[model samples]
Target chain A: MTSCSGTVLLSRITAGIPHSAAYDDLPYTRGGAVDRDAVGALVQSAADGDAAAWKALVDGLSPLVWSVVRAHRLSDADAHEVYQTAWFRFAQHLDRIREPHKAGSWLASTARHECLKVIKSTRRLTPTDDPQVLDGISEDRTPEESLIESEEAAAEAERIRRMWQEFEELGDRCRELLRVLMASPPPSYQEVSGALGIAVGSIGPLRQRCLRRLRARLVARGVR
Target chain B: MNDNVGNDSFDEAAQDDALEEALRRAAAILDPVPAELRHLAVEAYALHSLRDLDARLAELTFDSLVDALPVRGADVPRMLTFSTGDLTVDIEVTAEGLTGQVLPPQPARIEILGTAQPTATGTVTADEMGRFLCDLLLTGPFALRLRTDEEVVVTEWLRV
Candidate 1:
C-alpha cells in the first residue's frame, strides 16, 4: 500500500507554503493523514493563545463539523448559530476534554443538540388559534411530501449500505478505483490515474467498468 | 371503499415530486460559515489563551469530580453506585443507547460526565434493583457524578 504521507494540497494555487503544511491546512485531506495527537497539541496551543494553530484547526475541521450540522435538518440560520455557538462552547471547555481524540464526536453532539433545540422552539412558536398566524404559517401537510422524504433518505442509506456489501464482490483494482470515487470532491483524474498506474486516457473507461460491476452486484441483491 | 382506495393510490403516486421537493428544501437549510467568520474563530482562540491553564485544569477536575458521584434508584437498591473509589460502574448496554439514569437517595446534583471534550450528562437515579443506567452516544470510558443535598459523591471512572 502506498503511504498516505505528504501535505494535502487544497488548490492548484499555493500561497508558497510547504506541501505538508498546505496539505495539513486543507479540509479534504486524506482521513489517514490526520494525527489526533497533533490535533490535541494544536488545541492545547490554541487554548494557550496560539492564533495560527487555532486557525489551522478551524480550517481543517470546519467542513466535517458543518456536514454534521446539515445532517441534523437545521435551518440555515439555525445551523449557523449552532456552528458558531458550539465552537464558542468548545473553546470555553477545551482543558476539560480528557480524550482529545474524540473531539469530532463532541462537536457533532453539540451541533445536534443546538439544532434540535432550534427545531423545537420553532415548533412552539406556531399559533394555534390566531387566524392570521395560521394563514401565514400554514403549510399543507401533504401525505406525499412526508412519504417521499422518508423513502428517499431510507433508499439512499440502503443504497450506500448495499454498495459497500457489493464492493467486496469486485476484484482489487475495481475496489481501488471505486474507493477513489467515494472520496469527497473526488480525486482529480490525473491523481487517480497516477495512483493506480493506469494510462490517463484509460481512466474514464476503467471507472465506467468498475461502476458497472457495482451496479450488477446491487441488481443481484434485488436493489433498484 | 374500493374507489376511494384507488384514488388514494393515485394521489400518492402524484405526490412523489412534492416529497422530493420538501426533502430538497430541508437539505438546503445547512449553512456553513461565511469566509469572514474565520476571523472570529481566530480571535476566540486568542482570548482563550489569556486564562490560567491551571485554573482551567482545576475547574475540569472539579467537573469530573461532580460527574463521579452516584444517584440512587427507586426500584433497585444500590442500583446506581457512583463511587470515586471503585473506578468503575456496572451497567447493561444495547444498540439503541444507554437505557438508565441514576436515581439518587435524594435529588442530588448531577453534572456532565466523561472528559471535558465531548462531555455529556444525566441525572442520578437508581431503580428498585438498585440499578441506574444511562445510554451515552459515545462508547468508551467516562466519569460520573457525586450528588447529595448535603455533599456531592463522585466516582473515579466508569466504562460504557
Candidate 2:
C-alpha cells in the first residue's frame, strides 16, 4: 500500500522525470496471479484514504482503464480524460466494490464509457476536416464477427481471472512493487522509487527481494 | 486427457509459468490511460469528499467523479466468482447483485456433505457463451453444496 512514508521522496524523485512517459507505455497487468486478498486489503485501506492503497489500486487497474480507452479508438487527449474520469469514478465506488476479482473488468468498463463520452463531446466541438474521421465514427464490425471476437475476449479474460486467484496469496506490498517493476519500460527508477518508497539505489535490490518473496509465496500456495 | 498433456510438458510448475505468460499477453490487449489523465484520477479521487458541500456543487462533483471511475457499463456484476474448487458439498455461486448475463462453468452440480440435510438443490447450466441462469434465492447468507464428478466442493457461507 502507498503511504505518506514515501511522499517527500516521491515528490523529489518524480520531479525530474518528464510526465510524457505516463502516456507512452501501456498499463501494467499482473500476468501471473492477482492476489485479490491483497487487493482486498488495499481496498479496505484505500477506503480510509491510505495513499499507498490509492497507488496500488491505480497500478492494479491502470491497464484495464487504458485498454477500454483504446477499444474506443480515442486520441491521446480524449483517452487521458477518460482515464482520469475512470479513476475518479472508482474512488466513489471503492466502498461498494464488493468483488475484488472483477475490479479489472469494472475499471475497464468505466474507462470505455468515459472515452465514448469524450469522443462524442469532442466530435461536437472539433471541426472534422478529414472525411476519414466521419467514416471512422460510423464504421462497425459485422455483428457475427463482433460476437465471435467478444466471446474470444471473454474467455481469455476468464483465464486471466483464474490466474489472479492464484496470484492473490502474495502480500499487498509485493504485488504493488512487482507490478511497477513489471510495468513497461520499468516505471523509471524515480517513479518506482517514489511509488514504493525505496531509496533510488535500493530499488534494484528491493525488486529482487519482492520477486523472491512472490515466488516463495506462490510456491507455498501450490500456485507455480 | 490428462496423460495427453504430457508428463514433462504439463508439470504444475510449467502450467503455472505458461499461464503467467498468457496473462501478460492478455493484459496487452487492454488500452492504457495517458499520464495526464492519471494525474487527474489522483486529483479527482482526492476531491471526492469535497462533493458533499452543496447539492448544486455536488452535481458537478458527482459528474466529475462519475467520469473518473476506471470502468463503466450499463450493468455488471457487483461480485464475480473466479472459480470454485471441487465440490464435496452441494453447489457454488460466483456472483451477486447483477442482472443480464451470468457466466459459470458447464454441468454445474452440488456436493452433499456428511449426512447433512441438503437445503439447496438445483441444476445450473452454462449456455454456449459460458453464462448461467438461476434465481439467487438466498439473500443474507448463502453457501454452495456442490458434488462434482471428482469431488464435493462446498463454499463457505456468504452474505450477499
Candidate 3:
C-alpha cells in the first residue's frame, strides 16, 4: 500500500523533449532482462514515423498492457474499451510524452487510470449496486476483497471458485503480495516491493513464503 | 527444504530466478488474458500507420464517448465527428454497422477496412452528395479511407 504510492520514477534518462529523437536509447524488458536500448530505440522509431516500431512497441508491451487492464476484471466489453482507448490516447499524444522509452510504465499507468473511469461510469449505470465498487479501492478495502469483487463477486461456485477461496484464505498480506505477483509479464521484485510497501530486500524471500503458505492452505483443504 | 531458500541471498539474482513459475502458471489459469486482446492491441497500432509525418486528423471534434447528444430511447446509434485538414466526416454507428457522410459534399470512393487485414479491405463509392453507407459486419478494429481525384483522407484506426 505505501509502496504503490511511491513515484513511478520511469527511466527519464532520455531527453524529455518530444519528437526530438527516434527511440535510439535502449529499453529494458519485463523481468529486468536486458533489451533496454532496443525498447528505447523502438519508442523513438515509433515517434519518428515508423509504423513497424509502433507495432513492435505494442507487441513487446502487450503483456504489460493486458496485465494492467485485466487486473481490474472489468466486463469483457469494458476491458476492450479501456484497452483501445489507452492505445488511442497514446496515439493522440505521442508527441507530448516526456520519456517515450518508458512507455511500459506509462501505458500501465494510463490503463490503470482508465480503469477508474470505466468503473465509475459502470457505477453510474447500475444505481442499485454497491457504489463502493472501485471508489473504495484506492482507499480502505484489502486487496483480497477487491480481487474477489473485481473478478465478479456473485460468480457461482466452480473450480476456480475453490482456487480463489483458498487464495483468500492465505490472509491479507499474502493475498496482496500474490495479487501483485500475478500481474501479467510479472513485475520485478523491486517494483512489487515498492508498490506493496514491503522492504525491497525481503520481497524475494517473502514471495516464496507467501506462495508456500497458499499451497499449504490449498492442500489442507483437499484442493489439488 | 530446497537448499535455494537456505542461502542468505535476498538479492533478486538467485531469487525469483524462475522459482515461482508454477504459481505464475496457476495464476494464469485463474485469470487468463483474452485471446483477442493481443491482436486488438496490435491493431491499435495501425492507427500509428496513419502517421505519415505531415498528414493527420485536424481535430476529432466530437465522439460518442464525449459530446454525443444523449438518446432517450433504445437502439440509439452511436455517433462521431472528425475534421481533417480539408474535409469533415460525420458517422453514425449501430449494431448493424457504420454509416457516414463527408462535409462540403462531393462524390468520393470510401473504403471500409478491417484492421485484422489490410487497409480498405472493402471499397464503396459515395453518391454525388458525399454520403456513403456500408453493411460490413465489424468484428474487430477498423479504419476508413476516402479517396478522390483531389487526395486521399484516412481516419485513425478504431474498434467499432
Candidate 4:
C-alpha cells in the first residue's frame, strides 16, 4: 500500500518541508480542515498508511460522530461504545470507502446506525421522530456537565449549567438537531441531514424552530 | 410591505443565528468529545496495515438485536451474521460467552479483536465442523478475524 512512500511523504509534510511543488495538494497540509475535498485527500493518504492523515481525519470528524451518538441520548458508556465501534468500522473500511469526500456523512450515518443497534439491544423503545412525542421524555444530567464544573469559572459555569438545564427541557428531536448542529467547526447542513435522517431543505427551518424553542426556555429562566 | 416582511424574517433568522452560536459555544465546553475517545479513534487506524490488504471484510448482514423483534421476558441471545459472498460466519452471543460457526464447515483460526486491547484479546480455533465456542464473555467493541487456509476474513466490529 505504498507504506514507505506514505511515511516519507507524511514526514516531509509534517516537518514543514515541501515534498513537491504541489505542496498544497498534500492532504496533511490542511490539517484540521473539514471540507469535502480535504476529507477525501486525508482518506486517501490514510489508506496509504499515513498516520498524520489518519489523525487529521479523526480530529476533524470525531465531533460529528460524538454529536450523532449524543443525539440518541445513549448513556455515556453506551455512547462511547457506539463511538468506538463506528470509528473501528470506518478504519476497517478506509480503503474501500466509495466516497471519501462524504466521510462526515458516512461517520454520521454509522454513528446513528450503531446508536439504534444499542437502543434495540437494550430493549429500549426506538425514539420517535415526531418532536411533539419527544417533549415528554425527561432528561437526567449528563456526565459532561459535571466535567465542565472544574474547567469553567464559577459564575460562568453556573450560567452554563442553567443554560443546559433549559437545553434539556427541549424535545428529543429538537435536542438531536441542535446537538448535531452544535458540533465543533460545525457540520454542513448536508452532514446534519444525513446524521438526523432529515431532508436537507428542512434543516434550516427545523434548526430555526429548535433554536427558537431553546431560546424561549432559556429566556424564561433569565439565563440567556 | 414585502420589503418589511423580508426584513422581519431576516431579523428573526439573525436572532436565531445569535442564539444558536451561543448555545454551540456552551455545548462545546459542556459536552466536548472526551479525549480518550478521540485517541482511540486515532489508534484504530493501525488496525488495517499492509498485511491486511488482502483480507476480505465480512459485511454484517444481520443482527438479531437490530433486525428481530424482542421476545418479552426472555434472555434472548444476540445473533449476528457476517458474509463475504463465499464465506459466512454466524454467531450467537449469550451472557456467558460466544458460539459461532464458519460456514462451509472448515477448520480455521479466529482472533477476537477488542478495541480496549491493542492486540487480539483472545484466540480460538474452530473444529472441522467450523464451529467454535468461547467461554469468556466479551464487553465493548469487538470483531472476529478468521484465518482460513485460503484467505483471511474479518467481521464487522460490534459492541457486545
Candidate 5:
C-alpha cells in the first residue's frame, strides 16, 4: 500500500521545494505570485481527477492547516491525527466544496473542528479544568545545526530563536493570531478569521495590535 | 502632526510585516510539518478514486466526545452516530473493538476502512436485526462503509 507510485511522485514533487512547482506553473503566476484564483484552479482540476493538482493543493495549504492544529496546543500525536483527518476529509469533499477559492478556509475550519474534538476527548479522559496546562509539553524541535554552515546564518538563527521566545511570551490570543498569520505563502484574512473564529474585518486591526505588542516585547529584550 | 502620524503608522505596518516574515521563515525551518504527515496528506488524494463518488455520505450527527458531558469515574465508550436521510448508523467504540447497529433494522455489509490501509481492514455482516460486531481493535483514523440492498453509505472519518 505504501508503494503506490503516486506517493513516490508526490514526494518527488513536494521534496525540498518550499512551494509546489505545479503551483508555480499555473498561468496565474504573474511575477511568481500566488493568489486565491490560482488555488481555485488547482481545486477545480483536482476535483476533476488531476493528481498533480491535488499534490499542489496539499503542498500549498498543509502549513495553514498545520498552524491551525498547533494553535489548539494539542499533543504532537493528536495534532498529527487532526491534520491527517482534515486532509482526508478535504479529499473526500473536494468535489462538493462550494467555494474552491476558499479551500484554505475550508481546511482551517475542518482542522479547528478536529482540534476541538481532540481537546474535548482528552479533557474528559484526564479531567483537566484548564487546557492551557497541556501547553509547552509537546516541544519537539528538529535540529538544524547541519543547515547552519555559516557564522552569519548561525547568528541569524539565534536571533530568530530569541525572537521566538519573546513571541511565546505574548498572550494566548496574540500568539494564536500570529501563529496562524505566519503560515507560509500566507493565508487570506478570510481563512485566518475562519481558523481563529475572529471577525474578518477585525483581522487587520487585531494583527496590527498583536504585532505591535510582540515588537515591543522583542525590543525590550534587545533581540531585534 | 497628521503627516507624521501617517508616516509612523506606515512604518509600524512595515515593521510588523518584516517581523511576521521572519517568524514564518523560522517556523518553516524549525517546526515543519513532519514529512510523514505531509506524505499521508498527499496520499489521501488517492482515496478519491477508491471511494465511490456516488456513495451517500453519512453525516456525523453526533459524537459523544464532542457532545456528552463527562460522568465522573464512568467507563465511557466512544459513541458516534452518522445519519443520512432515513438511515442512521450508531457505533459504540471500545478498546476491544466496535459494536454498531444499522437502524430501521436491516441487514447490510460493513467494511472497516483505515487511512493507512489501502483496502478495508475487515468486513462484517450485519444481521437481520441490524446489529454487527467487530473484534478487531481499531487504531488511528478510520471510517465505515456500509453496503445495503438500497444504497452505499460511507461514514465520516474519525480517530480512535
Candidate 6:
C-alpha cells in the first residue's frame, strides 16, 4: 500500500497543484459536492490558454466523463480514448462554451455523445436503434470482477461487493440512471437529460424510481 | 388531500437522500476514476491554446452517414457538414485521410492538430476551388484550425 515519494510528487506535479492544503479552501467543494463557481473560474482561465487552470478543470471533471464512458460498457481501450477525446473536444469548444461553470455537464454530455457514436459505429447499429439493442455493451467486467476477487480481510469491501451485485441485477434503465449519477461531482439534471436524451423534467422522477428499486434490491440482499 | 400528498412526497425525499448517501460511497469504491485517464486529460490541456478564436463555429447540419448505403468490401467513409449562417465546410473522413471543401471556392489554410498532442500533426492549404486533402491522421482526437479571411475558426474536436 506504500507508494514511492517520486510517484506521489509526479502525480501532484502533473495535476498542477502545489503541495498545500489550498484545495480544501478552494470553492470547488461545497457541502461535500462540487461547486460550479470553482469550475467556472477554471474554465475561464483555461479557455484563455492557462495550462494550470486547464489542469484544474481536468482534475475536477474527469470523473464525470469517466462515468459517461463507462456507462456505455466500452472496452477499457475505447473508454481510455473516450476520456482523451472528450477533453479534446472540450478544449476546442472552450471558447464557445457559455455558462463556463456548467462545464461539467457539457463534458459529460460530450463524453456520452462520443460513447454513443463509438458504440453505434462499431456495432453497426443505426443511430435511431436503442442502445440496449446492441448486444448489451459487452459488459466487460473482468477488471471489476478481478478487483472484487482480490478484496482481502475487508468488511467494507465485502459490503460493496454485495451492493454491486444487487446493482447489476437492476433493470437496465435503473442501472444506467444510477451509474450516471454515481459520477463524482455529479452532473446537473439538465446535463443528464441532454446526455441520456431523456426529457429534462423526467430525471427527478426517474431518479426516484431507480433509487427506490435499488434500495429494495439491496434490502432484499440484507444490505440494511 | 394536498397536505397528505405533500407529506408523502416529503417522506420519499428523505429516503432518496439517504439512498444517495449510500450511492456516494458505493460509487467511490466501485468505479473510482482511473488515475492514468486524469493524467492524460491534464496533459492534453497543454497541447494547444484556443485563446484567440472565441467565436462559436457553425453547427453540423448534414452528415452522409445518415442512412448510409452499405458498400461491400469497402471501408465506410464518415462525412460531416458544419455550417455558420454564411459559411459551410464539408469533410469526408476515411482511414486513408480526410478530404474537405470550404464553400465558395476560396483559397485557405488549415492546421490539423491532434488535440492530445503537443503540436499540429499536419497542415494543408486549399486551392482556389476550396478543395484540400490532408495527410492521414493518427487514429485519435483531432481538430481543424482554419484561417479565414477575417479570423480563425476551429472545428469541434472529432474522432478520426
A1-224, model 5: which lDDT tens digit per residue? 32243344444434444542322322111122235776787777787777877887887788889889877767767888889999988887888899998999999988888888787767632221223322222243333443355677567667867777677668889988988888776678899988988999888888889999988888888888
Candidate 3 segments exceeding 4 Å error: A1-30, A33-38, A46-56, A74-99, A105-182, A185-224, B1-55, B69-72
Query: lDDT score of model 1?
Result: 0.44
Best by DockQ: 5
Which residue ranges in model 5 land beyond 4 Å of their true spot? A1-33, A124-147, B1-5
**Residue clash pairs of candidate 4:** none
Best by TM-score: 5
Measured by TM-score, how close is model 5 to the native structure? 0.84
Q: State each candidate's clash count.
A: 45, 50, 11, 0, 0, 0
- Candidate 2 chain B weakest lDDT stretch, 10 residues: B54-63
Residue A208's lDDT within candidate 4 is: 82
Look at candidate 5 and give me any clashing residue pairs: none
Count residue pairs with overlapping backbones in model 1.
Answer: 45
Please, what is the whole-model Cα lDDT of each candidate in the order they appear?
A: 0.44, 0.43, 0.56, 0.77, 0.77, 0.66
lDDT of 2 by residue, B38-58 (tens): 655555445334323221111
Taken in order, the candidates have interface RMSDs of 12.9, 15.0, 8.9, 6.7, 4.9, 5.8
Q: Summarize candidate 2's per-residue lDDT along A1-224 as a digit string, tens digits.
A: 34653343234323333332212233333222344455566666666667666676665556545544543445555555556556655665666677754555566555545555555434433221223322221233222223235666445444443334443344555544554444432334544453444577876655556555655655675644
Interface DockQ of candidate 4: 0.41
Prediction 6 global C-alpha lDDT: 0.66
CA displacement after TM-score superposition, residue A102 of candidate 5 (Å) = 1.2
Error of 1 at A220 (Å): 16
RMSD of 4: 7.7
Compose the digit string of candidate 1's lDDT tens values, residues A1-224.
Answer: 11111112222112232332212423343323334555666666555555665665666455445544444445445555566655655665666667665554455555555555555434432221223212221233332233236667546544433444465346757755554333322334543443344566886667666666666666788864
Error of 4 at A205 (Å): 1.1
* Cα-based TM-score, every candidate: 0.35, 0.35, 0.53, 0.83, 0.84, 0.73
